[model samples]
Target: MSIDTLARTSRAKRKISARRWLVPYVFLSPAGLLFVVFLAIPIIYAIYLSFRGMHVSGGGPFGVREETWVGFDNYIRTFTDAEFFAGFGRLAIYGVIAVPVTLGLALLFALLLDLPRVRAARFSRIAIFVPYAVPGVIASLLWGFLYLPSTSPLNWILNQLGFADLEVLTGGALFPAVANIAIWSGVGFNMIIIYTSLRGIPNELHEAARIDGASEWQIAWRIKIPLVAPALVLTGLFSLIGTLQLYGEPTTLRPMTNEISQTWVPLMKITRDAFARDDLSLAAASSVVLAIGTLVVSVVLLRMTQKKAFGDGS
Candidate 1:
């Protein structure tokens, strides 16, 4: 080939290589910018703030508010806080109660919907998912009213039947009362997730099982449930996260009962420390602790369930 032609070909190849390298990043720029601006920056700032303690001047409105670097003191205080540990204890119990019940109901509903010739399957799916569309604050308010002994229709029915009023808002019942709202809102959504996964399973699998004289229960137990185990694990992880961060329902119901303290849950305590006490440093430390704890728990759980869900462990 001529030198001129060879040089032109080399230039064309370099241009193509340059475009190939540039195209993906050009397309990803907007999303990458948004992730940095929204998520990454905030998390980094929170971690920075967690190491600093706040100090305000006594000099009125124009007073100087200094943020002093305190190393790990904020973290130490957060770890030593009685209210913080108490909140976690309550959350652990809440997780125990909420996660199983929510996942169980979601799985049950998913299986029922997966059944052949199930009546109003579409309608049932929509109805179950309706509560998921409702806002958490609104759901808390609605269930809070239902839990009140005086305003509750359940209480009225019990009274008419010569049964005493059920105090659902206090003592041992309080955990499940709050959990019920979480379950009511979450179960349908998880069901939709599991149900969608179930629908994705091939019809040939079911047909083969049936031909082998497997009953409907056997098919679901041995075939359907096993295939849908990943969905169950995912939903369980979400439920665990939600239970640990339990705040809304208890805060909403606080006005009606004396049982709930200002530090009812870890998130609630963090919120109070940040806004009410104007201690952002303490709040930041608590938030970091909560985030780390959640990450550890979720990683442990995923590892535990990995073999069953994915058929291999990493």
Candidate 2:
């Protein structure tokens, strides 16, 4: 071939190679733009707001309030606030009730469904998961009516049977009442994840266990559970995050009961600070703290479970 022709061919090949590289990025551009606009920008704005506060210049009611750089003042205020910490305490109580019960029920349901000769598995799965399909606010409302003494069928049944009324939405019962909303909505989703993981597990292991004189229960407890540890870890982490971010259910149910205070959970407190109290800086700081705390917790959990669940050596 002529030298000019060879050069033209080489340039053509280079252009095609560049086009191939650009194709993936072109496809990814819309998603990347969305992430930047919806997620990254909002996070950056919140962090910026965290470091700023409204300063009152000159004094008294006549003084002008202006946005000013406040350094760590917001964070300091967030840390020192009794209500903020109290919200965490409430979250701890809620988590203690919700997380274990949700995960346990999910795992139990997944296991039962995985068992041989379990009739109506599809219908059962749909029934369990339907609650999760209900929006959190709607679920809270549905449960709220059932909790109210006047409207509750359970209370009516007790009255009919000559039993005392149960105060579910008050005092100590309030915690479980709120937690139950979470448990009901969460279990089906977690169960689906666990069941999917269980299905992925090879049947040969179960066969091998059976051949070695192991019962179905032993095979599940030994081989299946261990193999699906990673799924459990994933579901547990999700539950932990959901527990920390508990807001919708409690907030929805709050109007129905006085037991849930305005600052019932950290997120609710943040919302109040931002919107109700108009303390944007304080709310931003609280949000940043929560986001950091959640990140740290997720990291710690994954690190601790990596070896056992994921079989990671590092």
Candidate 3:
């Protein structure tokens, strides 16, 4: 082609390439705007608030209160607060029970559903997942009724059977009671993830194992479990993060039982500080600490699992 013709063609190609690059950004603009407004701005504002404290400005101790920079004072208070550390201790206990049990049940259900001849698999899946569909507050209320001695049918049944009524919502039973709610709601979601991963595994692998005189259980133990390791890691990470941020269920159940204090968990404590106590600076500091702890835990967990799950040596 002549130089003039080639120059015209190059200009048209450049325009097409430019338009292609612009299209994705155009489509992404709404989400980008939302992230900045809802997440990024709020985070930046919280970090700023963390360093600010309210103090009396002028005349006396009861004088006008003003927001002032306090450096790491809020953080110091957060670290030193017994109640704050107590909340984490409670979380550790709760998580130890909830996380493993939830994931274990999920893995079990997923495996059962993945069997070659699972009867009513669709119905079973829905039955399991329906709890997760229920709102946390609503589910807490439903369980609260069952837990209350006055309203519990289990208590009525026990009375009929000459056994004492159980105190499900109090003392030692409280942790397991709270954990049951989490497990009931959480298992289905994690199950779905594992089931999806199981489905992605090639049928040829299972058939080949069977032909080699391997039992179904052996195939699952040796092949299926290894293949779905990534999904397990993902669900584990999500569960750990959720455990760290436990709030709604415990908060909702707090009114029903005195065992759950106002600052039952870390999130509840943060909420109380921010709203109930009118200590936004302390709340912000606590929130920043929790967020950082969550990030570090998540990164460490992912790093530890990646070599086994994703086969990433790096």
Q: lDDT per residue, candidate 3, 182-248, as tens digits?
A: 9999999999999999999999999999999999899889999999999999999999999998998
Give the Cα lDDT of each candidate: 0.93, 0.94, 0.95
Candidate 2: list runs displaced more than 4 Å: none
Candidate 2 per-residue lDDT, tens place, 152-249, comes to: 99999999999999999888899999999999999999999999999998888777878899998897898888988998999999999998999998
Instruction: Put the candidates in lDDT order, highest first.
Output: 3, 2, 1
Q: Judged by lDDT against the true structure, how good is candidate 1?
A: 0.93
Clashes of 3: 0
Q: What is the TM-score of each candidate against the true structure?
A: 0.92, 0.97, 0.97
Candidate 1: tens digits of C-alpha lDDT, residues 39-72: 9999999999999997776788988888789999
Q: Poorest 10 consecutive residues of model 3 by lDDT?
A: 56-65
RMSD of 3: 1.3
Error of 1 at 186 (Å): 0.4
Off by over 4 Å in 1: 1-17, 55-65
